[model samples]
Target: MSEDLEFDCGGNRGDGRLIYTVTQISYEIKLILEDSYPTVWILGEISNFKLYNSGHIYFNIKDKNTQIRVVIFQSASINLTFSPKDGMKVLICGRVSSYPKRGDYQVIVNRMERCGSGELYEAYGELKERLKAEGFFDESAKKPIPDIVNKIGIVTSQDGAALCDILKVIDSLNANIETLIYPVRVQGKEAEKEIPQAIEYFNSNHKDLDVLLVGRGGGSVEDLWAFNMESVARAIFASEIPVVSCIGHEVDFTIADFVADMRAPTPSAAAEMVLRSRNDIKKRIEFLRESLNGAINFILYDRSVELDKLILSRALTKPYLIYEDKISYLDELDNRLLKSIGSLFKSKSENLGNVSHRLDIVSPLSVLRRGFSICFDSNNEVIEDSKDVNVGDDISIRFASGSLNAKVKSCE
Candidate 1:
């Protein structure tokens, strides 16, 4: 198939030579536009901003009278200093080129930035997001401010009104906190470096400092830009001592404020925040003293009541009652002892009588008293049977009254 051809200057040329296709024509135009304006800076307000899944951003820069399409490819979008929104005024730098497929010319932006205060504001937001992602602004990372602040280290210009204002407020509140100043520029090219250095120095050298006040007097965002720097933010984050940020008026916010342990609306407010008022402290002390007195008085009164009870005790009141009780107890014990002894003797006497009656039942002497006599042979052994005696044997007869000698005659 043959494609349709057109020529830019075709009326002449005799032999009909300068013929070109639509694609060739579009490429020619694209080259001309790109060469004419290799790079240009344009100022306009963004009307339509669309970020695609392909990582390219499509948008329109519009004025009341006209508008132009702009595309930021992935490479340029990755370097964007801020997240751009519709209606935001911006100054873009890019080269104009035509798309051959659509046969349309547009600006291919290489770099984009916000204009005026928008620039600083955009950087601020970007940094805030980045640091937040890094956990620098986390509550868990922040050190807790002590309830009682004794010494404060200030990082600000010594001559600045911020320092003066802070001192005045501290004096007005009658705070017991003492201050140590580490003078540094609050705004300038050197401020970013000096501020971080000051923070580090104080942290390393002053171990007793309870808190740090970092801020400057009220000014524009540019004037307060030093506090927004990454160095200052990281320095505040790394500090072991609790940092109190008071970078501007109540309405202004900075990166340093987010990274600090505490944030106050103004420098004066920071001073008062770090320490309690002397009047409040005095009231606390007074309350403690009164409580201590109450506790001691209670103890003393209880002990006094106990002493009164002891003084009126029965043993202490009559004294002689002690001896009387003891003597009564001793007499009762003696009577019990005597009764026990007499009972023991009566019991033993009855036992002896019984034993004597038993002995009379079994005693040979009792038999003898009944007129029975025991006969003993020459060997002095008692003869129980008549066969034990001989006719002419001499023997002894044992009577109950007396034993007598006799000669045995006959068994009968």
Candidate 2:
């Protein structure tokens, strides 16, 4: 066997040999492992579990058929929740590679999961319960939908029946509302990442949208798993814009329904929920018009009645008669004044006659006629006796209308 495996010499050399270094051998093994196995999922029971002081985890995965060594780096090791025991079943996600120094193949685990019947479903339920207890489904966390939606954003698949249904509904009911579509995958492994990413994009970008409708048409639980994912639920809850979830049929409820601001049974129903019916608005306008017309007619009728009463009153019909009656009263007063003047003159003549009779009784001439005489000094005067006469004084005497003048010769 040694003679058949002899090495061939090509130039000057100490012996006929082919040389290979440790580093070169290890590099070739690394390339081969990377190219052949790549990344894969391995399910087996854990055995010979060990932890290094460097915080790395070393374990063996074994089945009845075969066994393989596994290593989880320190970064991934610290995040693991469950400890690996010798006989526990696990599913490891990792890349296959060979160690250079020891010349052995192992799996570098990135993630680990416990394997059992309905394990994925169990994980889903556990995560859901945990998030619910954290208040992710509280009513206070929900946003409010706008009353009059003008610009609407939709997150769903681009080539989906739900999109067409929504567009048709909006066009039939409220043609004026504008819609923006954000296309995303609706199912499969990529859906879990793409759907949530699309939701987050709209949350960050679509500030002008009145509301966002996030959903797809009806599907099975597995088909709708993307909407049930924690990533999608968080995106819906954290959205600044109000989200209306329309993910499935009326009977179906998803995590999105609990986290969204509003929920609709279908895409068409979501569109209808956003827009007001045209006939309803028309009926309101007609009712208001009728009320305005009725009010105006009532006011006009009241004003017309007041104006008719004013025109038909006595003051309006017989204004000239009121002036004529006033003039007749003045004429009667003038005739009465003339008759009073004539009566006053007659009374004045009678009063004057009585005054003359009274004056005759008290006259001085009457006293003279009674044989009493008024005496004066001798200048054309009558003497009462001889003593009133002076020597050479002129004297006068009168009786009725006759008079005599004499010179006094003696005085007694």
Candidate 3:
């Protein structure tokens, strides 16, 4: 039976020969692998990992002694619980299959696990520690919230419950203030990057905003991790506009809280802090108006009293009283003038009598009364000497009342 089954087709029976074709051998190996093993687990270090655009992951798993090729379908790769990196030790569970055309074998992975805490989480922690050391969470950089803000910019999910609470509070306080909402992701992996970017965009575009209100409703720390991200903190600190961080329940605090201008216990509280009730302002205005009216009335009463005093004085009520006071004084002045004129006339009469008596005492006619004769020339001039008479000139002799005319005879 052994002799009949001997089939050496490459050479004659007496000569030794070898027979083989690449395609035939490969086909036989594929059949053996398909028939023998369904799937198996492989533990090795990953190498030459590639993610194709078609969503397929291709890689090589290598050990110190051997290595194997791997291909994970797009669906399976997407469902992977952890991200894998080159040189990472992992456990891959899949089926071994042979490629007839390439004449090779590869493992098609359905599941995989990292040797430790995984690549994605490791990167996250590393970045977080680096940012924390750089003081991204420092409180000194925080800004103070304005007591009254009429324009507020909000960064949160559009459909989130936090937005509803904020709106309700704002409406109750002051609805006149404008609120601008910027919708963004609030959770998950994308949130870590997108939330910060959204805040930065608003800061760059809306510089006129009075304040930024960033928040969400209550959630676990992991759920709110986006707010604690370094990018979010840096964005808040660098913003030119003030920020109000209201990122969960009262007990919650994030990195954003430390970097923002102020912190609110909740989203509703943040809204209340930014706006004041209209009733309060109205009450204040009413109080001021009353005080002003009271002051004006007091001033008017004082001025009225001054006017009454001025009217009662002599200068205002009686026009002729001032002239009556001066009339009596005028009579006294006339009496003084008459007495002075009378005294002056009497003194002048006495002086005239004295002068007349002195004239009589010195008269030249007194000499004639004493028996002395008076003589006159023809011209009525007195001839005192006999030698003054000329021959044939007429002369007059007077003795008191009588006079004699005589011709000038021979005079010795």
Q: How would you encode candidate 3's per-residue C-alpha lDDT over 159-271 as one tens digit per residue?
A: 99989999998877646877899888888878877777777887788887889988888775568778867677778878878888988877566667766788887888888
Of 2 and 3, the candidate ranking higher by TM-score: 2
- Residues forming the 10-long window of minimal summed lDDT in candidate 2: 1-10
- Candidate 2 TM-score versus the reference: 0.45
Judged by whole-model lDDT over C-alpha atoms, candidate 2 comes out at 0.80
Clashes of each: 0, 0, 1
> Compared with the true structure, what per-residue lDDT tens digits does model 2 show for residues 1-412?
2332243333446776655556566656888997887657676889999999998999899989899989999998887768878888887877899887698889998777665554665666677788789888888887777666788899999999999999998878745877889899998889888887877887777778888989999865568778888888888888888999999777556788878899998988988887654435657889999999999999999999999998987679988887888899889888889889878988998899999989988987777788766545655455667776668877665654555666767776
Window of ten residues with lowest summed lDDT in model 1: 1-10
What's the distance in Å from true for residue 177, model 1?
4.7
RMSD of 2: 34.7
lDDT of 1 by residue, 1-412 (tens): 2243343553447886775677777788999999997776676889889999988999899878988899999999998878998998887878999888899888999877677546665687799999999999888998988877778899999989999999998888777677889999999989999999999999999979999999998875579899999999999999999999998877567789889999998998888777664456778999999999999999999999999999999878998999999999999999999999999999999999999999998999999999999999999998989898889999999999998999988877
Positional deviation of residue 201's Cα in model 3 after best superposition, in angstroms: 1.6
lDDT (Cα) of model 1? 0.87
lDDT, each prediction: 0.87, 0.80, 0.79
